[model samples]
Target: MTTVAHTPPSGTRHTVADDIAGVCEAARTHRAYGEEHSTLHPQVWEALRSSPLPRAALPKHCGGLEWGAPHIVEAVRVVAAADPSAGWAAAIHAPAGAFLARLDPPLAKELCPPSETAVAAPVIGGSSVPAGTTAPAGDRMRLQGRWPLVTSAPQLTLAALAARTEEGTRWWLVPGTELRVEDDWDAVGLRGSASHSVSCDTLVPAGHSVCLTDPARIDGALYRFPLYGLMAACIAAVAEATAERALEAFAALAQTARPRHATGSLAHLPAAQEHYAAASARLSAASAFMREAAGQAWHDAVRGQVENAARARLRAAGAHLAATSAEVCQSVFEAAGAAGLYRSSPLEGCWRDAAVASRHALVAAHGRRLAGAQMLTGSAGGHL
Candidate 1:
């Protein structure tokens, strides 16, 4: 089910359409295997690096699509719908596109050579947070830190990390040769994310590093994209997919579902009908909003029409819509009742995956509120 990225149009013409469709189809294969592919199947991780979605959303200047968050919004939803773990993989791919591309052109060139594959697992390891950096040497940063909860740390070739200093905030690009992976990404749902701990004690060459919060203003719109927005949109998108699967399953159940001591089938029940209908409506709404919002942001970013304020608005909207969509999709599971509780049904997986995925720190109660609060306070969402 793996495929290459479609050739992009001269500007932002028509390539994203085909690229998104392909990401949707490819993620399904990973979804089919779910967590089994994590420790058991290294091939799944390998496929992800070579997959189109990661490359599709990359920075255009650095051999990437430069689609901004909109690109992520479309693809992540499809991937999450198939597998939450895979969705996370794609979510961070934007970092590869955004931060990685911002490195000195030659550094970017060295980090990911033309014929070689590169992996990045970021851990901000200051106390419990993945927030520390290696001391800067003459040309290379002398790496000496360990970041836990790094996804794919076990296999990553590079580490994208942020560290605070006396002067300002900084980020760097370190090689896997400088890292040590510690198996720590053990979770209930996205266990396959390969999110673990990593230790580094090597030098990150000057050409391969950049201070994301440096004096220079980097113009990659994807860097301006919101983590919460990207994460939420992906969940919302998956919810839409799950809703579709649930509806189809519910429809079949409607024709044949029968309960004891009941006069007619579950579908005949007014309550069941209402709940299913509502769930379906929510699913459709979420998908539509996701598409519209994502498309608008990406298109605007490419055209230089969206500034930080506009981008924040889009991020806030994406987070809210994603949160609402998750809620709506959960209703479908409720409507499905005990029969829809089949262990193997896609509905069940959708419920668990969406619930756990939505619970990401970015979309949590506080983070969601913060986004709204930022908008009201005239503050940009987090950092630019």
Candidate 2:
């Protein structure tokens, strides 16, 4: 499952897809192991480590590819099509580099040194919720709190946690070793994400904290892109790709699967054909909408004028994609009949993954409501 490093030559254009092309097969081959063990397979993890996806969103100076939102979403889709859990982990960890840009240049560079190895793009995991508290401790800060749903916790090199301080809610960059990881992620779907809870009660350098309200030190459109919109789009991309894979699995199953009490294969049934057609069309439309929305936001960000309207559109599209993808997966599952109910069935896994992904707060009803409020009243009264 090991893949040769595919770092492009200087002055040559390379894509996230090209960088991760070799890992897709490994992802497919080890998906079951991850699902069974509740963590990414070691081979797949090694392949990913060799790839540049972990630092795709980082600035070039920071030893990253600095990919745009649309590109990142496409990469996530590609990986998810191979394995939904892998895709979920990629989506969760890929954009973390942006958080590092909030720190001062020296500290940011020190934490993410320029290297020709995976250490340059360390795997990061944390929650945005202010579930912890921080206090001034002379020359340092004492941070204490428990954050849940820390994806890729077991492999994180650095953690980006949010805690409330006297100033306000700020993000802290604590070494993974300082946190106590609790292996408690037992979700039915995305079982391999390793999204366990992490708690920290250690003193960190005073310079480790960053107030998101402050302007970003890095100068780039990728850094300017709306954080919430980017996260929502990434999650939606996973759901969309998972649904697409489910449809493909159902199509393969229909070719040889015979319906009970029927003389012909499942593909011969008009109902099954209709369901497949409808699901495929819906998924295609949803995927297109998601790309368009993310692209528009990125364009605005590049121009240094990301309007609230653009953010609203992206958020709304993300929510729509999540809902549509879940529906499409369910439709494909139903069309597969009892054949899709087995635990080994890929369609069943897609259905479960989509169901769980749709429940994510970023792409939930609340986001859609906020988007609608902004579009109608010109004021969301909250972050879009």
What are the models' TM-scores?
0.78, 0.92
lDDT of 2 by residue, 267-344 (tens): 999999999999999988877787778878888999996788998999999999999999999999988999888876
Cα lDDT computed for each candidate against the true fold: 0.57, 0.83
Residue pairs of candidate 2 with colliding backbone atoms = none
lDDT of 1 by residue, 3-78 (tens): 1134445554454436445444555655556566454144556556655655554444445555556555556655
Candidate with best TM-score: 2
Query: Which residue pairs come into collision in candidate 1?
Result: 58-66, 107-207, 124-130, 124-131, 125-130, 125-131, 151-195, 152-194
Identify the runs in model 1 with alpha carbons over 4 angstroms from their true place. Answer: 1-32, 37-40, 60-62, 67-69, 115-129, 136-139, 206-248, 251-254, 381-384
